[model samples]
Target: MLAFSKLTKSQASYLFSFGIVFIIYLISYIISPFTSNDTPFYTLIGRSILQDHVLPYKYIFDHKPFFSFVLYGVWDALMPIKTGMFTLLALCCAAGAATVASSIWKTNRFLVFFILITTGAAFKMLSGNTGVLQIFFQILVLYLLQYPSFLRIILSGVITAFAVNINYLTAECLSLPIIFLLYHNKKIIFNIFFFIFGVFSGLFILFSPYLYSDPLALIEYFQQQKQFLAAYSPSFTTRLFTVIKLFCYVLFFIPVLYVWVQQNIFQKQERIDPNSILLGLWFVSGLIASCISGYPFEYYYILWFFPITIMIAQIIKKPEKNFKWFFMPIAILTLFSVVDSTINNIIKYRNIHAIDYVKMASLTKGGSVLNIRALQTHFYMADLKNFDPYLFKEHIDIAFGSRAAAHYMHDLEQKPLSVLLPYQGCEIGAVEATVCHYLHENYQKIYEVKIVKLSGKIDHFSFELYKRKSGA
Candidate 1:
């Protein structure tokens, strides 16, 4: 074993940081196999691709491209369906942790620890979401930006394309190419070609045979996205909180802003270097994208944090003792926030008893298992087999979310389907009618009753199994 005593401060710090991150990754991997919402959906899609050979456009609810292909591909290849999702989620978490560690390493090593503790990076890793992969690509692009070689430029473009496939919002980081063009004015043509190649490659993967029967499905997908954007509402309070959270997420941005301000006032020539301009533009672009996206989720905004963190590091090359103090409170707050969020998530996971619900639905006979107002459809699918612990029934038709139900109902010829509606947000009459109409065109007066809990709590207004009267 290598001795720590003989190593220099920098070497020792690097090793220690790697060890800590690896340990966190290992722990996350161990716990990730437990059931979660999206896990089964991913598995289903992957299985569909492999077993049924069906393109996913008609079945997958969301219009986003087949971005999860690689993730699911690896999952199917490695473990059994359910186990694969957990393993893949764990790997994604590891990749994300590694990304954050590298991005922050150049600037301030302490901040990485702070991010892990504050962000509940470990918990997020176990959550089995794509946020980690998103962060990984962001850092990869930033690292590539530093190098000026043709191969690096091409690689960066390819990575950016892959990033977009993983999550369309990640395409926002393509702005990095513009920054590169500005920095390398002499090699503009090369940058253009590199970008075009990457875009085409990404488009090909996005529109693979597994995505749609016809390539036009890609166009339909974009049209849907347009509608979604047009209908989005801006939340000012959410925007303000996001801004504050990002600033606090990294302690150095405040100082970086101050530096930029000082440079502007003094009209300093050296301060306006290519690097500063690139970093400034990136930060601004990311901020605008995050703000405009509306109803900002934490992971969605975290992608931009990588570049901002790196920029902040570039700003504070040599710091005073006083500067270190600035990070203490920020670090403490971040740690607290991460811990709090992790604990709350854990509680929610325990309370939901998601596996039990899935199993129960699987065992119920004759009709499809409908989870109204459910968040993650995949988790429900994963639990179907487990619910019949005695191995009674083999499989059940599982559907969740308004969109998923809508899609399924559109294809079904049967009427009077029984559904188990969860106690979600306030039930809207119009929404329910719209859902009901898709299943049955004609109205019929059927038995109706309000479902109430044993504790005298009003559960839901149930239209007791409505079906259209024949020839009515």
Candidate 2:
């Protein structure tokens, strides 16, 4: 403890920020390494790129954009499959926390504490999606506020554009904020021209390799992405729940917004320009995108977590009146949400327990395995193949009637030797059940594995092993 005193305030704060982030990740992922479908899907995509020497459109599903698969390729090259992904995910979360902490240091020293807490809680909902890295990039856009130069402005555009490759929604959320900045600035054309140049160069640098590797696949990817978006139609209840979730986020910031108004408008103490309104618009755009996008996956919340947290932090540092009313209640709610989500995720994934991944590996030893919404990651971990490219629900939707489903069904024409029907429901509302029924008739179920909770409760799910029947 005496040795700790030797460090300066900034040094100590850095250590604290990193320690909090590290602990958050370590505890969250101790048992359940695979957090979401994204982890396996991306890993499988990376492996497909490595083995096939092409992008992963054939073996796995990916719709983000061109450069996303490129990063997965880099991920594949740098690390082993399962363990590597878990470690990388932890590192990304830590990096995001570190980025936010570092960004807050110059503005308000104490803000790092709130930033870490908020980011940790908010990020828990993601379960380590590309959102972690994307949030870090969004944080970089905030830091651009400090060194507002021609160079920095240009770099900001580049960074923002580059972030789109990570996830296209970021561009949707941030583009308006960039326009707002340019409009607010004294020089418009200068910033716009340089910003456009930087953005073009960055896009070229990021996207060129993907085009060179497989332009046709890249074109098909965008087409599929559009089709998926056009096809998505969530339930009215689902949309209502999503709006409520976004409102909860907005509610969490009520105190901060109140404080900002009191300080800037009522008190007239500070002139925190364009950025004051800038980050607000950025946050709003993200929420708008999340709401309107038809699919309301919770991780979409990660898009604006940085800007909103940073804005709240800035206001929290200097409030006109007692802000505990806001902080304490929101703090309690955020903490509860964090813990609750974390626990549910643990229980949800707990059934994916360590009870013989090798047994399933032996079942799918040689040929490509169709995951059937089961342990797709486990199959990838076993170094077996997922021959069917249609692993996602969207693909299942497209398969029912659309021509787009042909790409996915193309490989299935051969009827692979092994199949895994893991979920008990086997309920693909729109996906043609006849296709699955055909498999049942043609194949013989050789083995079964039940997925039961630690409390001795069966999840009503079983992982079945199937082998093809002899030649008819």
Candidate 3:
């Protein structure tokens, strides 16, 4: 029952911007051109939790921390609307980024609104990646660290611990906040000691479920997660290409780096702002984290959006004639890139009904359903149960190495009533020779629907469903 009249201009502006971003995201999800690979995987885990009351680590083989799934689970349990959940997560991210930018720039906070919503990271969040939600928590810590009180510093530590539970790699950001404490506070030792104390306290609270339920299982879970990550390390060459793609292809990096250079190298007379130093450190931390797994995933770069946008706002706040020429073209190119991506996404939307998930669901009823060489989305959309520990192809390949095909062959022996293949019939993973041969010989092709993607070109791909032959 609050009136807008009582609120300050800044507060009202934030509310209006938040509403606009949320509505835009909601509409974006409704007409989203493509679905990300990770969405279906996480949604399935959320479904399992709500319907079966079992954790992912216990029910299925998953390496991610439990917070995100729990968030999804709780939401689905209450409302069970996919688009609604996506809009909410996207809104959280926009709000967090806007708040962080506001803390840095007293005026022209709306400029960040445009920078954030137009970026590739924003689109990825709209496509339903839980990693976006983790960034929400990460930004909370970032904002809290800017002006440090003992309570605020301690709270930031607790939130940092919570963020790590969302995704352990965010642990790299731990140093940035601690460095803030050292820079800003006179009683560094006392503040840092309490910050560490708060972190441990957060961990204890978050992990209490595992501790009370089965401490050994929690230990084993981390061990398995560590091993899986270690085993899946990309080669040095691959990691180098990932870095190249991030810096060279993403145009937004230009302004962020330019501002840093302008401040540090060009304008040496003016004393550097402490806030700028922390933002720089955060940018470095995000870059290091993004490149850690050597994944060219668009969502990983989301970590950079907040700090980068804040840096972009600085150019608006204090214009320097020195690099005005360099900055102008870079800014225009970045905007064009973003606008092109958005139009392409909308243009790619196809009216063709790709997969008849309903018929597939009916055909696969009363028996197990397996999806091969298809996205896990096939399982979720059709409401089919995936009774395999290896939910993803990459995970299986990484976890089993040479034994991947053997594992697939073993799963085939279960004789799932219907096998869904998004690729052509008799086609599986590279090592899936035995799987292809077995499916061809024993399973009957009952239904298929062309998968017309947002690319606007039909590659002649279809989701083909197969049933085992009678007494095969």
Q: Per-residue alpha-carbon lDDT of model 3 for 1-472, expressed as tens digits?
A: 3787898999899779756654544454556423465655676787786678665576556677876677666666665455435545665576666776686545355776656665543336465565567667877777776677788878887888888877776887546645774567677787778778778888888777778878987787788788888887888888998899777644645755776658654676767766667677777777777777487777777776556766767776776666566465545554454444445444433321355668878988888766665556667667787767666646777888888778777878988787767556454343367888888898988987765555654333356788999998
Best model number under lDDT: 3
| TM-score, one value per model | 0.65, 0.81, 0.82
* Candidate 1 TM-score to native: 0.65
Question: Model 2 segments beyond 4 Å from truth?
Answer: 1-26, 76-105, 108-126, 145-154, 233-237, 319-321, 373-375, 398-413, 423-433, 453-461
Q: Per-residue lDDT for 97 in model 2?
A: 56
Instruction: Give each model's whole-structure lDDT.
Output: 0.50, 0.63, 0.67
Ranking by TM-score: 3, 2, 1
User: In model 2, how large is the Cα lDDT of residue 263?
Assistant: 60
Residues 55-130, candidate 1, lDDT per residue (tens digit)?
5534344333466655655665676554335645645554555555455344464544334333444235345555
Better of 1 and 2 by lDDT: 2
User: How many backbone collisions does model 1 have?
Assistant: 5
Local error of candidate 1 at 364, Å? 4.9
lDDT of 2 by residue, 99-163 (tens): 55455443553454345444446655346567666766766765674456788887877887788
